[model samples]
Target: MINMSILKSLGLSINPKLHVTVLTGAGISIESGVPIFRGKGSMWEIPEARRLAMRASPPWNNKETWEFYEWRRKLVSQCKPNAAHYTLVEMENYFENFCLITQNVDGLHIKAGSKRVLELHGNMWKGRCMKCGKIIDLPETPLKTLPPCCECGYPLRPHVVQFGEPIDNKILIEALKASKEAELFLVIGTSGVVSPASQMPILALENGAKVIEINPNPTVLTPYMSLSIRGKAAETLPKLWKSFFTD
Candidate 1:
């Protein structure tokens, strides 16, 4: 269990006035049965999968790409939001300024009832037209076509920041702004290695925000965190919230 005294010393509490920003990754969703693509047991680590993902882009192997994401979307749809997701929803309601920045495209945060989420990567539940750039929400079931088409007769790609693709500038700007203004930053279940997203915590720290890391393993940012709580987010976050606030 994390020592509450440590949190108190850092000036983080159940105060409604505090501005809290949370950054999440695949780890948070793992307990809910989501498979991560980078770490051990990652599907992407498999050579064929890696090759497919690498070439899974429009104007390339669009069929394989769409099939891959379609499979993922179906898999994610079968999972439910876990305790950690609910804990975040509670935090959002308790704080005046709460921003959630997630690298996950699963859309679980929204399903968990968090309102102020900034998706660094686009959502899997949505698609963007390759030709006209129109974004649309995907249905729960897989599409009948390999690459679904937009009204303009152009193929619609998964609304995600594909490998080698740059993150949307507007989303990046908002994340940076939130990090800079945060009083407390929570790093949850991320690898802490990916660039840009990895820099969010650094921005928060530079701006004088106290950071708390919640992960079962040590990450690159662990050494710099104000307090490190070693546990799965589903098990750790609820206890942390209960320690701070009780209804």
Candidate 2:
């Protein structure tokens, strides 16, 4: 059981009627065996990996891009949702209003049975046609073609928000709306440095919402959090959920 003294010092309360919003990042997926593409020791930090990823974005380099996404899809397919994912799903059921905003492209939260998730980064399993703009589920791995085409014969690319690309306006609007209205906000496993998305916790604070931060290390938003719990999400979230909801 969590120490009540700690909760008192942190100014956190458990109320089922509260409107809650949770923002998650790569840290939550790390326990599920997903590799973060950015940050220290990330694959993208490697020179060759960065080169390939950047090259994969253009039509001229579509084959290389498709190969990379296919590899990622296979890895994601093998991963299972972790304890943290299940805890969030339980939070959704307990709260009167709940919105889960995630920066991960992995669909683990959805796979874990979270119904109100907003994927700030697009899903890796989906593909979008470059010409016709039709989105579809990518075919099975070891694809028959290097870069498959849409039914309209246009090139298909991974349906993700790539670096230098803007997030979908519709998704961003919804995220902002949720943040502005939440009564309790949770920041889990994010660096709290990435733009726009990183500003969410602050928005919640400005709107008079209480903020809880769960991360293994201190980040830019640490000082602003009403409660800062330093631990892995997979290790901490289940305990948090039980402490607050199960009495």
Candidate 3:
């Protein structure tokens, strides 16, 4: 359990007028059974999977890429938002100024009823035509082949950012601006290794926001956290929300 004193400190930090920014990652979605793709002993550590998500020239041509994504889509289709996701949604209702920025492409945050969301990574359930750039909502039914565009007759790819592709500049700028303006910042379930997502906590700190980090393990950003709650978000968030709202 996280120290009670830390929770008390966080409660003291909250102000009715302050804007709250929540940064989320794969760990927050793990209760819904989503997998984390990074760090030691992870699935993406496999050379083939890494090559598939990383190397240039359409890794989908490789059976491993196709099979992996197919399985991933299936898993995503079955998963639902867990308690931690809803806790953020509840926070949105209580906090007049709130921004939810997520590294997850699972779409769980939106499904959990978060009204304002900034998806740092693009979504997986949507695809775009390679040739004409038309967005297509992926069918709930899985497809054996890459889905083709109705308009341009070209193959479609997941809207997500692949390993080598750069993040959209407009989204990055918005996330940065949000972090800077927030008076309360929460980093939820992320390992804090991914760049830019990792940069947000520091941005918040420099701008005088109190930083609260909730993760099961110690992370690279642990030392900088004003309050570090050590637990899975599914368990911790509901508890923390209880402390703030029902205590």
TM-score of each: 0.91, 0.89, 0.84
- lDDT winner: 1
Candidate 1's TM-score reads 0.91
lDDT for each residue of candidate 1 in 7-113, tens digit (9 for 90 to 100): 57777666888888999999998989987777588877667667766657555326778877876787789988999999999999988899999999999999999
Badly placed stretches (over 4 Å) of model 3 are: 1-16, 44-67, 150-152
Write model 3 residue lDDT over 1-247, tens digit each, in one string. 5334444566554446678899999899877887667766565766766665554246333444445566677767888899999999989988888899999988899888998888888877767666676877765647746543435666677777877777879888989998999878999989889998999999999998889899989999999998888898999988877776433
On residues 1-247, what C-alpha lDDT tens digit does candidate 2 reach at each position? 3544443444556767778999999999998999788767787766765676666756432899987787677768889999999999988898878999999998899989999889998888778887888987764676778687788987788888888788999999999999999878899999899988999999999998888899999999999988889999999888877666432
What's model 3's lDDT at 129? 66
lDDT: worst 10-residue window of model 1? 52-61
Single out the weakest 10-residue window by summed lDDT for candidate 2: 1-10
Candidate 3 clash figure, as a count: 0
Question: Model 1: residues >4 Å from true position, as ranges?
Answer: 3-6, 45-55
Q: Order the candidates by TM-score, highest first — what do you get?
A: 1, 2, 3
